[model samples]
Target: MRYGLTFLALSAALAALAVLAGGAALVLLWPAMSFGLVGAAYLARRPALLGKRPDGTQAAWALVLLGPYFLLTWATWRAERALGRADCANEVVPGLWVGRRPLGDELPAGVRLVVDMTAEFPAAAAVRRHPGYLCVPTLDGTGPEVERLRELIERLRGVDGVYLHCASGRGRSATLAIALLLERGLAADVDEVEAQLRQRRPGIQLNAAQRELLRRARARPGA
Candidate 1:
């Protein structure tokens, strides 16, 4: 029964693809595809409900589909690990680290200040236990708030070691790291700051608005 359900689901998916290719509207095939998916999920959860067993050929087709399913799952797992490596934290400068939220309680010694740029506080109870955890909620955009962010960073920089992060450590955190580098005169320009960051954190990303904000902030008098 499970094998039969798998075949039906696969067939429905193929039919949906064919309909899409034929220039038919998706609404025409969505019901069939959805019904097949629901049926398969139901059978998977309660295999005994079907009572009857599948023949050998039906079982074989099911195994064939199952093989790709398992392979795809493994590929997804590996890809996630690779992507995690790309986003792992790295020291942007001496005593300064940036990346996605760090795991475990074993942060490096001297990391006394943790600046969280995420819109919401981190869910980890362990993270909240840090001695100096500061949350500065912001998004990736240009606004008067950039000046306040600079001020926040300035206060945090007085500590010996600072760790900066956001939800993904890609947009808002990277933007602030660049801003910090500019404020400190450690980087001559946005391009230079970005180059340094990318060298240390391979997947660091900054949106157009963040880049423009950095430029405008850097150009302001006494910035």
Candidate 2:
């Protein structure tokens, strides 16, 4: 409540200043500033609202600052579509997709299974509505959980159109995706998997620990 009031006060002050200054650029800039202030205040008060992904918030605020409120809505929809592509969540292969925490309704039609790799439950209530949702809680490391994940992936191979996700869809999600690729013999080795993932989803990165986990998973007896 306090933050909301502060944002209103700041926005009014800036808008008033813009009116008094009578400068065209300041008039244009004040709206963006006001939008940014609102985003900052809301995020400060509830950092977990967007979970681990700030890009969505950032993009929304940017659009709000640049145009009318209605236009902001349109931009948000477009941004979401772009996000799936930018994060390489749309489709890594013919029937496989990877992404961050996604709500059940946001999933593409005909997704037979969802493999959630987030360490904790997602904030979205709709995620629980998915019939094939499976949560595999795991931290960002090379632990026993990796083996468990491999086993689960192996068991789910027959299922088509699987969607795998983590909190940010960058590290853990990519790790599991690569692991699955190797396990299924889709790619020849770790380097091949990495090359393919990067080719499909540019800027996909993995940490040392995750890379090491993949290496160990690859070296296992029947891996």
lDDT of 2 by residue, 1-223 (tens): 4444555666666667777776674764556464445545453443332232311222344334434422443465457656755642657887888776676567876788777764323425565556777766554332224566668767777668888776556677778888878877888877788789878767568877678777876676565
After superposition on all C-alphas, the RMSD of every candidate to the true structure, in Å, is 15.6, 10.6
Worst 10 residues of 2 by lDDT: 49-58
For residues 1-223, write the lDDT of model 1, one tens digit per residue. Answer: 4434764776587666768776655443544543454356344533222221221011333334344433443465456646655644678899888876565453566788777654322324566667677766443222225567657666855466888876556677788788878777897888888888989988776767678777766666565
* TM-scores of the candidates in the order shown: 0.57, 0.57
Give per-residue lDDT, candidate 2, residue 132.
76
Candidate 1 matches the true fold with a TM-score of 0.57
Best by lDDT: 2
What value does the lDDT take at residue 112 in candidate 2?
82
